[model samples]
Target: MGTTHDEAAGPRRRSLLQAAVGGSAAAAAAGATTLTGQAAAAPAGTAAAPRSGGRFDGESPRFALAVLPDTQYLFDADSADPDPLRATFRYLVAERADTNIAFMTHLGDVTEHGTEDEIELAADTFGELDGKVPYSVLAGNHDVSGSDDQRGDSAYLRAFGPDRYARMPTFGGASPDGYNSFHTLRAAGRDWLVLALDWRVSDNGLRWAQRVLDDHPTLPAVLTTHDLAWAEDDGEARLSDNGRRLWDGLIRGNDQIFLALGGHYWPPGRTVLTNDAGNDVHVHLTNYQDRYYGGAAMIRLYAFDLARGAVDVETFAPWFLTRDPERRTPLEAENVELTGPADRFGLEIDFAARFAGFSPVPAPEPRPASDVLVRGTVAYWRFDRAGLPGAADEGAPVADGRVVRDLSGHGNDLTARRLHTSGDGALTWSAEHHVGQPAHASLRFDGGQGPDRGALLSTRRDAPLNATRFTGGYTIETFLKLPEPFVGEHAWMGVLSWEGRSGDAGKTTGWSTEEPTCSLNVSPERFLQFVVYPHVQDADPTSWSHALPVGRWTHVALVNDGRRTVMYVDGSRIARNPTQRSTGIATLGKPFVIGGTQFAERYGQGFYGWIGDTRIVDRPLTPRQFLTPYR
Candidate 1:
């Protein structure tokens, strides 16, 4: 972790998510390039771009790498000034401190037309950054002079040849035309190599990328191409033309290449897969070139903060200077409308920890759910094993690391997808605390941490768990114990929620309202609450009931039987709300979320304590059936 800015004032670590951090050190400490780069800048008649929100300390060992997706808009023939593109580089120079920005990568499409003027625009803008910080660029489909079939990026090479990057310590080698290359850098005491390839890599080019990885076997690698992963309707990512070939031919065997990044396919998507060697490979796709004026000058920031055991990702457009409307024109000049959750969020990934035996691969075998009381269990998670088969394994299972095992007949297992990608080892299984009734382990969720870092379980939305088409009453139950010190805090905490996105449950869906199937929450006043959307608003004064006992094992359950809804605590009715004569639960399009919902605000408000057996049945349980004693 980096030391605080003012150590003498009082030793305190800077806020991991807040606190703006850079501006080219004082004149005396400014490096030669920092001074020369800004001095040589052309007068931007327009207002300056806004400062990026991401910040870091001047002396922090943690670093960030900025990914500048498709800059084809900067090369637009209709543009009055190429200020957006220029602003991106300037933003880097301004926020250089907070970011500890080690490198910048352009995911190709640097030009709309392969003309000399456009090429120079990119070259000159990047040139200003040339001496200050090392950067690399990959060729996109639009980078060449001719159509796709006649593609050739000779101009791109001439502008960014070997000579241009020879001084960079990490520069490994590049193709003659500079369409393919690699760079090496260090973060969190680990070495990394970034390989850049053309829009469509040839067989020879693939071999070159492979050879680069072969030569630097000790270094982790990130491959940048023009087009790779694309989003699918099912929410899973599928590879494109070049992507498929690269994966099968080059990436499949290379254990060193952990991340494959690309642009060109719009609507960003990400997926992680385990290679033949059991190493987790993360593939990410980002492209804003088709949105407002070719992506509204947005850039992706990958902040690797090992101290927090997570990677904080942010998307900010330094060029979208909206504070001063006079300068905040959408397309003509600086963009003004691009800030949203889709563009910014922290993903829990602690690469440093993962590199140190924090394997992303699941254990080969995991324990199955133990036979116990309470029939009609449609989905369950014991958190006992660490393999895919999990609680569903028919054979005797072996305990691996921590895993959220789904004991339900349906394999609706939970996984920390975002956290895994960002490199955090998600949940760590604990045997210290649990309701030993079923003789199963539990999971401890540490609250008030970074985004989605709380104790939560995420399972993919599948048919068996798809509540969207259900027409029956339902029951949800969980055993949890809150820590003694956590009850009085005036912050909302989540118990369980169901939806597509992460945290809060209720969300708008199309023309019709899609209330969360249900949400089990703990209010700021320590009250156990149950909320059903559409029929019940979140702000309803009666959303909650009496206070729950603190620091004690408690079993909470919610049962809806076609009309009225009743809440139970430790097998006793605690609260009830009579509802209109309607179907008990609304079908949801998202997955079942345990411990937390997908609402962004309550992202870190996960239950802080031990969560024992959690089970959900499609039908409501009778009072007697619900309180059955455990063996």
Candidate 2:
């Protein structure tokens, strides 16, 4: 059985039933008992807003999972009021497209009593989501007669049995007793499992859950139940006795179970536990029945951003949102959204690495040089040959004076050169490369300012690339990642640039005459800056990009189609591309440099990051022709 707590322990917990009906008294008096009662309360002849159907984007890297917890207080047998719950359902249905809500899961305690009247009302209210959103529900202690899934023939089971979800695409299966169920939602290009377990699951139920895990061994799972944990005033949650039992019998042993959610306890909280596989399992308890207006039908949205490897959680009361802001009471306004640490927060999980044990994401193999040698390719340099017989091993210092052959057959080979005062460890070979990069290795630069220390690879004094200017157009592509704690001293470091000064090229329109004719650099704020001095025009057209996230590999491309320049990061065109004409690059007969910029023919600092395969083309190429394949 779920742990019982006082619903009205203090003045703050007193019921707001009367206050909630202040302006909507006429609607409350109408006593409309259907799921659409809230809509019926609207003006005559107006139909309820349409629900979002067939709008979910399951393959999006970013999506949301809606969680409704403990609506028991709103479904009491005689005082039943389904308006609040209906309002929440409407909100989820309307925002489904904008939020990319893949699925909804109700943490059980759907009614105040185990009576047929209450369960029936609750079930009817849920009809608002019947065909629109896929969801799962289970029996709470309040909705069952006895303490286990084996307890037969309850109102909750009769209303939410396998028959209720047999037609749903996400429904996987239900236990024989129809009290425990599992759902498989296709999201983020993969299948995810949601286990809706009874408040008191029997040993037989646990065995059934194990079988489900065995059937789909690769799907990450979220275990949901009614009774799991209780939180203290400070919002630190501790597992209840029943929760401990579930952990021991089902969750802790299953490597695929990464998140566990429950709602029987008040004062929502969360904690992290280590499973037998030594992976983290996030255990969360969310419930607000003790709050004003029976918790106001609050819903929690877990926004999963796979690219960022994080889940942003937000709790808000949709019922309050449906109310008029100008007529809302102070309490109603306060309950609209929750910003407390325990209620709203973010969880970071490296999805690929976390699921690697069960579903390993294969690393892309290095592409052949011939594959990326697109038309008009002038230069292509890749460090993937590291660990070869004559090359530096992974993580080993790049030897001074080592030569890197240009794969384009352009005879523009580059040679590694260490700064006069820098140490041998200034640069090293790294096996870490972008997931989509053609190469599987990169070069790590440990350069810094204040003394101008680092190593760089530069073309020979007479290399053809240093003298040829792309009059028709040009494309420069490179995959790079900034250090996690990019220090202040490493600000304004250069990733790649031409070696000659703009002044030397006779082009004076630039941030500085001493600066390079063309350069790609990281500003102090980590913004990507692409500046070029055009040969046909004296104006320097510069393209600035949003701040790049540290510690994540990014593919950057600068495409100039003879007229204007556009910068693309990870295949998406940035908003700050310059409109000024940029016909051709101004060049001097000097060595082109990578890993550092030159000011008046002097290196101030080398790049403090990892640089992967780089390619330069004399003609502007589409994203499909870039080294890193665009998705």
Candidate 3:
């Protein structure tokens, strides 16, 4: 799906997430890279992380690291340019936030006036994260703003490298560097919990958060710090302020204190409430320095899933024109219902070392210390997006000979289409049929987060192509949802992508975008989802995720090794999308039958639902090599 830079203009397609495993199949028709240039280079290909947000392995040992609270950016009160928490710090440098993420702390001020160059550009962008995801930082009050601002506390300890108090390696092991320490960490596999509370200093982070939750009363603890304790018993010395009697003695004595992340308080708390020995706690308050990129119009994606026992909340903002609609509305908090059983252990995963290694990749950032390119030209507007010829007016293939011409999308059906759902929402489409069948435009419309119906037959492209230097290695396959028995189905479907990092449709762009995607569903229980992109703002790569379902369909793929992203689901493999800033030129607009624009008027948001027997192939396939070519 990559055409439309004006074969006469107006139906645009181009956002296969910028391809390498998929769109680079042309690399802008032979130039190798230069759809235009927003640059920030580091993915000429390889070291992975660019497939398309989904999977990073799981049988349920469970893994996550999308945390960012009390994070700041400011920009210029005393010299602040933290570029608005660079969109959740590019999701903590492309997620895994540190694999089972038993590490990652910030309940500090990170920036308000924490100057010294906004604490060294937020400690060189959190030192570019990805040590699997290990991190550490603390210094709120806008990074030492009180006590008469102790002279900017030595520029927030030489730029957030750590000071106001140290110690955070499982807490007390091999280091002696912590602000209030006590760590035990092992991660998804087990061991759980760690505590790094220093709240500047007073009541001194509740006696090391009560000797680190009395030495882990049943595991899973997380009491990093910035502060939260006001239930009005009038303690008022501020900071952890007694955080409501240490959150009611760790919520009537532990279910593992749940989670209480905080920041320096900007538009902080709105309500996290949870009680009755259900023990689930949540205070998570954030927004500082002006609140990065789309600059604090609100931002918090939050989660806590003991295998779906529940606990999920959302609160995005940045459609701009703000002054407070509560920072432009959008506080969707509801679905945290998994109810019972969710501790699977991701299955000791050795799968013989995952079928034979190929995982090691963490040594890059040491090249000449900063090319400083994340290239610029945002909000650019020069649409030649594809139709380029000049080697003497080239133009003639594409009658439909299987597809492939590159250098900016080119004529029609660029390849790729599939979507099917039902549970009373119906949706189908795999075009021209044969290979698993489809041609109904399928259907889905239940609403409320699912069988929330489906339907996608893509060809207009637009999955994130700002126009070139689009790095390489790309792929995308389909089929997932495999499992039926719902003449009255219950909702779920798959296949939908956008990677372009969309924006515009009511306006908003404070940064952070992976662009609404979805795939592999129909689970009585089985997982793989990309429903991300909103570490606080920046969205509009195009969008896809009609709720995916249709039972027993199985198969899914995405392999862009530009910087991290590799999600498969049937041929096994699951999740990974690490830092891929789209290259553009992959559309699906207007109603060219829902994707051709200039008419349907709503492309990126409506297609109805249904897909089957589709194909976007060029690479990444392997469920016995895509069922041995469908037998």
- Worst 10-residue stretch by lDDT in candidate 1? 27-36
The local distance difference test score of each candidate is: 0.60, 0.83, 0.36
Indicate the worst ten consecutive residues by lDDT in candidate 2: 31-40
In candidate 2 the C-alpha lDDT for residue 228 amounts to: 88
Pick by TM-score: which candidate is best?
2
Tens digits of per-residue lDDT for model 1, 1-631: 0011134235544332221222221211221122112222222344444344454343454678888888887775556257666777777867666567877888888888757777777787777676666788877767675432124447776786677788887688886545788998766556678998887787777777777877887777788888776753233467876689889988878777777888876556677877767767878877776566566567778777764566666665555431233333334222232333334445665464444332243322323354543566777766554323344322222232324556665777776432212223233445533333243556656554444345456666564575543246667777887777763342566777766331133435322233344567777777887766433332222245677666767777777664556777766676445453434444455666766744532254456666767777767786565533321
**The candidate that achieves the highest lDDT relative to the unseen native structure:** 2
Instruction: For each candidate, give its TM-score against the true structure.
Output: 0.48, 0.88, 0.23
The global Cα lDDT (0 to 1) of model 3 is: 0.36
Please list the residue runs of candidate 1 whose C-alpha ends up more than 4 Å from where it truly belongs after superposition: 1-61, 77-80, 145-153, 232-236, 322-342, 350-353, 356-631
> Could you tell me how far off, in angstroms, the CA of residue 612 lies in candidate 3 after the best superposition?
11
